[model samples]
Target: MEALNLLESFVRSAEAGSFSAAARRLGITPAAVSKNVARLESQLGVRLFQRSTRQVTLTDSGEQFFQQVSGPFSTLRDAFASASQDAGKPAGVLKVSLALAFGREYLVPLLGEFLARYPAIVPDWHFENRPVDLIQDGFDAAIGGGIELTEGVVARELVNTHIIVTASPAYMKGRPVPAHPDDLAVLDGIVRRSGPTGRLRAYTLRNQAGDEAQVAQCTRMVFDDPEAMAHAAMLGYGVALLPTTHAAKWLESGALMRLLPGWHADNGPVSVYYPSKKLLPPKTRVFIDFVVDAFRDREFAARFGAP
Candidate 1:
């Protein structure tokens, strides 16, 4: 077990490029992680890493050792974990990446209930607007829309991400209400630039009656984040296209009103993504199940689709 711990600390540190980050993933102190690596190096009589203030780089011998040991070590760990999980509770640091606004509003609120249900698992969640490389970043899971479906990763969709045109009541107070999708062209538009592409997003609105209209709003404000766009709309900046997940609370609070209510854009579904591992970790599996069940119980699928 001690040798396994030492190996795990070294592998995690190599993957993370920093002792502190490896410690966070291992649920240990940085000093402990460093000591483990040092111990491993002493046993092998090889200097494994070149350490600096900000990060660590693997030495040539260390890289070779890592390549030799990592795969076998992972298989061993998974086998042991599978046996343990059959008899014991799921326990470990469960790291997840989440979309910023939606995660804060929807997922973060479920933390209390989740922790109560699985007290042995520690949540280390990162909230960001961009899609993350789950394998490279060492995340157990991620939740968002439009994430690239990379090889070895699978996405279980939670909700249909629908976008609706919205504006604050104050913004529309003296303005002509858009009776059709074409009417949105003359309104002040709070536009969004694609974070990954660095280009303006062109939305094509659709109605239930099988009509499609390319939305070309008069650009007034530009933003890269949905949360920022929602905030700007609430502050009466302009009409904006928002996903129901981001606009739900504001719309409920009367801070924003849906415009062209019958028209919407269907982006891809917001999904919970995880690696397609044969022996998925117990903690990751449980978290995915919990999120799915929570969505079902809360009717989040229905709520995030139309509102």
Candidate 2:
């Protein structure tokens, strides 16, 4: 099939009367728009535009091609719009990947209300610790911190993410609580191993005043997932640095307490990502909006300590 982007470039350039104008409409550079139109011209073996120093005007062959392509293209666009309207009803298996602990603690609970609103949408959520190839793996969306941005994938920021060193009351009993980063050197540490990198994750702890210090790990055990590390700390394993989203509930319940209340490890934003912005199916779109609203309602960015 012919590249639709090439056709878009040609048609947009034709309508807008300039490559720069077309580029603005298409969210690309003028050079890129010109290049796409040029490629399309090469593929069709016809000169499409008469380019002057100031502006571009369609050639006779280009005008004829546009006339032939425009009507059917308009109809196709209308058909797509109609189909998109139908897709808006939210009836499909909504496959999404999410961080394990956050999903279990936060997102999974929101499903009842979400499903009540969009009954046709099935929640096929995959919760894991590491990032997945959202495009190659056919995932509808992914929610987590530190997701790498890629072409055609759009990430909407949901909340700020941070890691805090915490331990259970039982574990902290009779043990001197760490007063500083250097104090952690004497404490038994539960460290996390990155699934993708296979390296022990070390965090630079920071205070509200922007002072930074490297955490010294005296690891008694290594866990891959945040929940695992948190569990280990609760089981009296050691003090663990964990995402505040995962540790928040426990901290509230007294299962975990902050080691240094002033300091936290910033992990950047937790975002909900989809493949593209154009013509999103209803299920994925609603979930993205729903999660954003939920996080807003809770003011999760501030609650998670990265705000």
Candidate 3:
């Protein structure tokens, strides 16, 4: 068992590139990981890593050894985990990355019920507006749109989010409502700037007839966050393009009105992502099923569709 522990520590540190990152994935302290690797090196009578202040690089011998052991080690670990879960309740820290506004508005509300059902599982959730590397970052799962489906990862789509044009009633009070997509060009546009790229987000609204119109809104204001853009539109800053998930509440409350209802941009599918493991950990499996079921039960796919 101790030998297996040493191998686990070495393999994880080698894959993660540093003791600190390996510690995060293993849910242990960096000192413990470093100590285990040192012990392994002592037993094998070989230096496995070239350590520096910033990172650790595998030695030639270590790289060869890693290639030999990693595949089998992972399979053995999965088998053990599967056996343990079959004999016990699903338990462990479930680390997830979530889109900030979408998580707060929709997913976070389901936490209480999730926790009540799986009391043994602890939730470690990070909310941000960015794509994450699920395997490298050691997350159990991630939820949002526009995330790359990297190798060894799979996505279960939740909804096809539609980006619709919207604005406050006050903003359109004296101005004429847009009768067509081209009319949005003359309106004061509260636009979104891409967080990953500095360029402004371009919108091309399409209707059921397969007709498309590129939105050339006069940029009156800009923001990187969708929630901020929605708030700005609610304050009557200008006409804004927003995903239905972001605008749904205000639209229901009459704070914002849909403009040129026939036209909308397809924002693509919002999905829950996880590693393509043959034997998924029980904690991750349950969390994925829970979220997928909730979305289906609530009919979020229908709710977040084009108007």
Candidate 4:
């Protein structure tokens, strides 16, 4: 049990990046965290971290050790959490991170139902448009589009997403609708700046002959925020490219019209991801199950349409 405690302390401290931060998270003293890590290192005869006045960094040996131990530790943590489920209702905080627009437009409503179903569990949620390191941040789970899974994390597909090109009816009122991808050269184009690389992406449209071709050069407006780009498109500022899920309401309302509908690319998948473990906590398990069910429901499919 002492060994288990030390291992848990060491893992949490490594993940959190600081003894003080880990101690606060574990409801223990910084000295206790430091002592446990020291004892763990002594037991293994290996130094885990190089400590400094401002920060702590893992040694090469420590990184290899952590990779080996993290999997089993996750399993043990999950098994322990699962065992506690039979004692009573799940009662703890669940930390989650998600895309801001998706969280506000879809997940927020979904969570309302989840909260009602499990009142004993509390959630601490963070929404952002940028990528985050879930393990480093101590997040239990994350819901996102295009999340790349790495070692120590498990990713489950929740839904398929489609990309769509659209323009406002106002913009179409005077301008000739683009009959081909090449026609976009004369029309105003709105582009999204890639979050990771900050590069502008332009879509290629397919011809009736099924030959792929790039859109022609046009006056381009770039925006980092998807919501802002969509709004600008709605105001007839330019042609906007966005996920089908985000543009669904506007398409239904006839405020925006899909352009080159047959040429859009599939945006891959939206998924819920968490640390890979042998057994998930009851609350987290229930949440994952709920999201899967919600996405699979026929009614839900009707709203988002076929991917």
Estimate every model's Cα lDDT from 0 to 1: 0.89, 0.83, 0.91, 0.79
lDDT of 1 by residue, 107-200 (tens): 9999999999889889999999888988667789999988888987999888887889999999999889999989988899999999778899
Best by TM-score: 3
Candidate 2 wrongly placed segments (more than 4 Å): 1-88
> For residues 220-262, what per-residue lDDT tens digits would candidate 2 score against the true structure?
8888888888888888888999988888888888888888988
Sequence-dependent TM-score of model 1: 0.83
Candidate 4: list runs displaced more than 4 Å: 1-6, 20-32, 35-48, 58-72, 86-88, 206-209, 298-307
| Per-residue lDDT over 110-177 for candidate 3, one digit per residue giving the tens place of the 0 to 100 score | 99999999998899999998999998888989999988988889999998999999999999999998
Sorting all predicted structures by lDDT, with the top scorer first, yields 3, 1, 2, 4
* Candidate 3, run of 10 with poorest lDDT: 78-87
The residue pairs found clashing in candidate 3 are none
Cα lDDT tens digits for candidate 4, 1-307:
6988899888888887788888876779988999999999999999999887756778999889989997788788777777776465765788889899888888888877888888877988999976666677677889987666777788888777766678999998888887777787888888887878888866665444667877654657889887888889999998887877778878889988888767665666778888766676888887888888887873544555432
Q: Candidate 2's error at 82, in angstroms?
A: 5.6
TM-score-superior candidate, 2 or 4 = 4
Candidate 1: C-alpha lDDT: 0.89
**What residue pairs clash in candidate 1, if any at all?**
none
True-structure RMSD, every candidate:
3.2, 10.3, 1.5, 3.3
